[model samples]
Target: MAYDSAHGFSCDCGQTEWQVSKTAKGSQVVCYCTDCQAHLRHLDRVDLLHDGGTYIYQTTPDAVTLIKGHENLALQRLGPNGMMRYYTSCCKTPVANTLSKATLPFVGLPLKGEDPRLGPVICHAHTDKGTSGRKQTGFAAAGWGILIRAARAILSGRRASPFFTDAGEPVIHPTVLTREERRIASLRR
Candidate 1:
């Protein structure tokens, strides 16, 4: 039941596995962003939002390694300009969330496969961005310690992310969407 791993995590269906850095290398947080809710809604997994929050561990993209079922990784966006969300294509299980452009070296690691060792939520984010009209708590201290940690990572040059190569290109090619397709997907009821 130990979630403290320098190894990483696996999907529910065992179709995908991603290696993560040490638990100390990432930030654990809960998010209530509208986009997050919408993504869950699109996947018909609103039930995973306990207290209207999605628990995730934020880490550098370089810390992740797709150890198995690379083809099972699928991508989605809330809009033409939204962040690229990656999931298991086989079972449609979300694995990570990242920016469309690879400039940012961060990824939100979902806590689906983690043991109870993930510890307390560091902070809540975008609590004011929920679109479901269901008021959720834990917004008073959003983005609390993230800024400092991110700055440290950036300044310290710890951003040699595994998501990209030395040439600054994505390791995996996501299913890019046109504006029209993005519109339809985002507007899904």
Candidate 2:
């Protein structure tokens, strides 16, 4: 379960865990690129960065681990024949879960259930490899919103961009989607 401090979390089994600071106050975005899709296949999850990846990107490797039941780890590559797609053996969770602490530190292990902790994914990579017409999604969707909010945030004389603000923090209250998302969803329906 997630900790209040926003720095660490322990799983129900106590075997898997991860941690990251949730002090930052920005909206988290989702990605659906080939890499992400491939990762989904490898992880055997339909929700990669969407429903997942909230805790995975925040925790330190030391804070995350599988205390037991490790015989279920699995690995495979999805994109090209040369690429490697790593995942769990039984559940096929994200490959991000099983990486060595030595090489990957910034990445986190995705949890089974929880509101993902991510902000408008400001950037994306490898757009050229998109299988569908959709590429470079979140940045555009959230760019205007982010810029508008960031501008109002800390206009402290053009320093580096800040990812948090008291004004634009996560809302515990329920809110409706914008006209755009509603329109799209309605059309799809």
Candidate 3:
């Protein structure tokens, strides 16, 4: 069941290009968290969600490669302590999300243009806040698998992500949301 280590992703306007891992190696998930909802709302595309959930494929930062249009990639945050949401500045297409701490090895890529061979959903996360009222099947098994694999990737010295420099700085500093903007985004949380 080996899969290709590389897969391509891009924005609607083709201003950005990304190389991410395939689903066999990456953790495929459906997230129903408030943060995900707020992220889509911030981009004015709440419609990205299917039943209030977004399909995401998790991989180490090192697994993502910015192939082109690096300058077009931008970052945004919901608040001072929110996940860093990356997008295309040209078309505002949501790209990926990462923890503010560069030491963390995980980044979640939106599965909008993924290949069908990536297979079906593995698990559901944040179901309590899921707006669609649907349950994720095999959550425990899939969640544990992801957790274990992520830990291995982190420990194996693969944290030098494409989104950050070797010195552990974001390629582009994120735009922190103001108090008013945070308040608005938090209303849905």
lDDT of 1: 0.67
Instruction: Flag regions of model 3 displaced more than 4 Å.
Output: 1-5, 113-115, 136-143, 185-189
Model 1, span 1-189: residue lDDT tens: 213556567777887887776644666777876677667767766666755567888767766777888878777776667777888878777888887666666788766523355556656666666443554444444344445555667787877765556787555766655666545544654
Superior candidate under lDDT, 1 versus 3: 3
In terms of TM-score, which candidate is strongest?
A: 3
Comparing candidate 1 with candidate 2, which one achieves the higher lDDT? 1
How many clashes in candidate 1? 3
Candidate 1, residue 118: the lDDT equals 54
lDDT score of residue 5 within candidate 1: 59
What is the TM-score of each predicted model, taking all chains together?
Answer: 0.74, 0.39, 0.84
Indicate which candidate wins on lDDT: 3
Model 1, runs deviating above 4 Å: 1-7, 113-115, 128-144, 175-189
Q: What is the C-alpha local distance difference test score of each model?
A: 0.67, 0.37, 0.75
What tens digits encode model 3's per-residue C-alpha lDDT throughout 1-189?
A: 112566777788887888766533666788888878777777777667766678887767767778888889889988888888899999888888988877757788886633365566677878777766776576787667657767887777666677777787778989988878766764642
Please give the distance, in angstroms, between residue 42's alpha carbon in candidate 2 and its true position after superposition.
4.5
Model 3 steric clash total: 0
TM-score of 3: 0.84
